[model samples]
Target chain A: MPTTPAPGTVAPAVHLLAGALRRALLEEGGGFRLARVLPGREDSCAGLAAVRVLGADALAPFVVKGLALPAQDAALIRAAVRAHPAPQEPERQVLLWGIRDAALVRGLAVSGVDATGWEGLAPAGSTAHLLRLPWVAMAAELVRVAGAAPPFAEEAVHAQLARSHLDISRGLVRALLRRDLPSAACLTRWLAPAGEQLTTPALDYLEIAGADDPRVSLDTAIARRLTTGTSP
Target chain B: MTRANTPISPQGDHDDAADRSRNVETETDAAAARLAHQVGERALAWLECMRGSFALTAETPDDHVEGQALKSLAELALAAGMVRREAIAGPQCADTAGRLLDFGWRQVGRGDLLYRLQARTPAATYPMEIYAPFAAAGYRHERMDRLAAHLLGLRASRVIEHVPNRRLAVVAAAATIGVTVPDDVAAMIGQTWLGGTPEPWMLDAGNAYGVTHTVFHLTDWGGRPEGLPQRLQDYLHQWLPVWAEVFCETRLWDLLLEMLIVGTCLQRPLFFPAVWERVAAAQRADGMMPNGLTTPPADPHAAWRNHHHPTIVAVVAGTLTLSRAISHATTAGGEA
Candidate 1:
């Protein structure tokens, strides 16, 4: 029996959790249950070597769900994140890139603490985390997300603009909202090569998004690329 | 002889400098007056726009209906309050009020709009913006109480939250409607200063809103000091001059107006006079206020919406600051 949903609190991400985790969230607490279910601190760092596999999509769902963690659990996740190798600490980096829960972001911003799991990824140059990653690994993840849809035509060299990548796009928007310029710029930079493989709207948005641009769309531009195989 | 050809004596030069300084003052005065008039007109325009149909521009179309509905109603409530207070007014105030109330009633109970808007998005400062208008409109219902409770709960639960602006917004909004702020909320605000007055994050585009929202909420939309802890007040009174300078240099009209309102809230007339001057000079003749003095978007519609933000800010800040300025002047004159 999950705790009766808090009135007016309907998180789309909450549904992504299995019933057992949801039950834990209800009976125990959001923070405690999340920390219990997450990859343990050892497991967290073990995945460090597989940075390529830990893309935003694979990470967003977990991080978004982890936001409900109580302080102790939140700290546990943070501690786990800290234990990871600096270069391969993609989970915390992704969260800091603005993939974490909305409330968590608010909590971090208000508490004046770095909610971005790892402490070293400062706001000033957080993109260094993403940029430091092997370009091929990052680029491959982008292709995987963008190419999830079937090809539009036989002659098309790239995948057609198909379904959207909600998690990645939402993270991008969150990054933009937090004014995490380093992260936003890093993500936008990664998308630049895939310019020829994007949808029209995605291409337009990419042209418009910058570290300093005030307005940003919640839509994931890169994920919806309508590349006709020609460079944008 | 042409004035340029005239050789000036020391006495003449001194007198000339004095005349030039006096002329500058006159020009500044003229500009302020012009801006005040334009702001008044533009405020009325914002109200009129709301009186018909209004959409929440800030939210994505794909956001949940509750988010949209809550944001829309909150904006409406604020607009209605603005109209009622004559912060933005027209003969259409009555009509706008009717439409707003009707719209509000239609979507009142559809979801947990209140909690979803407030607690779910704690960093957002717009929810704080909603408080003054909703309270000013004298809106009281079970939902409002629920919102008030949710805000209080968030404060109690999160020992220290991100976005000082959002914390201030919740505390200040609760204060506006006569809700007693929990000790924790007050303590939470005090915690912000514990880090030795967090330097204004002005370079971050979002902080422009965050900093101003902090000022507005801390001061309770320029209403009273009950919501503000004394230490925070002193901290703001000391640092506002520097913050206002930074905001002015950025030439962000929305922020400049927000800084003006902060000055009004603190009752510190001297804090942002230079910013006030620049804002007045930047006003267009037709009463539009652009987002900033930076390069605008290439698209015309995008450009117009950008203009809309500052124009609305100008209305709220202008109305509050100008009216307060007048009242202060009148009171000072009376005391003299």
Candidate 2:
């Protein structure tokens, strides 16, 4: 079992990754600028070096050497870290932080890795969904940025980015990222598409019909779908 | 419409800070109680207002009469201790003011009331006009209308307490239609109703008329279950369908479904299990469900999506309701 950090200690490894990623973006322009400025053009130079040191990958050694977790656990953490590389773009970096933050806070361990050293990352369609996650402080900062910036238009890319971080089945975030609709209506449309493709129908139904909305038809549709497989 | 021109601190008060604290505490308590009472009383008054046979007629009170009548009545009512000034200034009073303003505009447009008393009334006027009879009843019609309008503007600040974005839209639609929702529901709308002309949708004759009818159903007609279920059902069946057809997308459809499930748990318990079963049955192995039965997928995410949060909440709520119902049924069977 992975050793857990004390409450007051540095946030568990996953959080460290998210926090470090966030700090890299807000304070240090993330690794992109450092990569650009570095002489060797090596992946581990400059800002990328700092991320490698402090992010999810760095936690394995600390857990193995400092916390005394098994060597195999550290190896697993190293492997997962290698698989999900640090995000390059500032927006993608923030999104990674949000997903990891949500996962850690929820106590969900990433599979095939040290749960304590987990990094949360998920695909999200818009800055709005990224901000809507439960990480209050980070989400708030992101919200502030979103409010100041122009509305995001690249829904497909954002959706892909969100999926990479979380365990949400495909297309869930994409459905949420579509043009604004009343909350209830949006959920209804997501759960039960009028289209013929039915992959992952249960999850879609769950996603769309779980929240509130002002539009009554959306609710009715969900209720109808839930009760009769027909929109009410 | 009167702005506070003079600042008067209560006399014999302590230092400014102490006085301010005491004033704030007293004002806050008073405001709370006053709002509570105003909301309750105005709701009652609205019921009464709609009870009698209301007909749209072609009579317009003279503008001067309307003005003087309101001023004299305010003074008499205020002086004679018949009505408190705060009664006209309270939150409920503001809600009334808003409704009446909408009502007045509708009446004018319908040619039931003249636009200007001095001008020729519309050529084809409806009979049985409903003018501001309160002016004749010793209340200031114009001032009362003004006070209502002003109060409505002030009360709009409450809208800010609601939730944001889509949630806000839901609460706003409810408020626009004069549906008194619980505080939690109101909080969903998340913005103050700053003083401005009400939205066109809010004031639209059709919506306004619909509100009047809904209010009547809620109050006088004693519509089933206080007309809440019926009102909600009507909104789902009629108003919201149109809105969905017009502006809603697949994601919005998902959000709406969640709201309905939540709403069913909150408002209509009987329908909970049926709704849940239908949803559960429709779920595919990968956990995606269709949006509406017949409509084309509104978006790509309409397929291959799994949202755990809403599912968990719905499952929990549905399980509880089902357990209780089953227990009830078993007990009844034993007794039989």
Please tell me which predicted candidate would have the highest lDDT against the true structure: 1
* lDDT per residue as tens, model 2, B94-172: 4554444344334444322232431333221111112222232233334323333333344443454322332333333
Q: Tell me the fnat of candidate 2.
A: 0.00
- Looking at candidate 1 chain B, the ten consecutive residues that score lowest on lDDT are B4-13
lDDT of 1 at B285: 51
- State the lDDT of candidate 1 residue by residue for B217-273, as single tens digits: 665566664445565566566555545655576687777777676666665342244
Best TM-score among the predictions, by candidate number: 1
Error of 1 at A227 (Å): 63
How high is each candidate's TM-score? 0.44, 0.23
Off by more than 4 A, model 2: A1-110, A117-232, B1-33, B36-126, B129-209, B216-336
Top DockQ hit = 2
Please give the distance, in angstroms, between residue A146's alpha carbon in candidate 2 and its true position after superposition. 15
The lDDT, on a scale of 0 to 1, for candidate 2 is 0.31
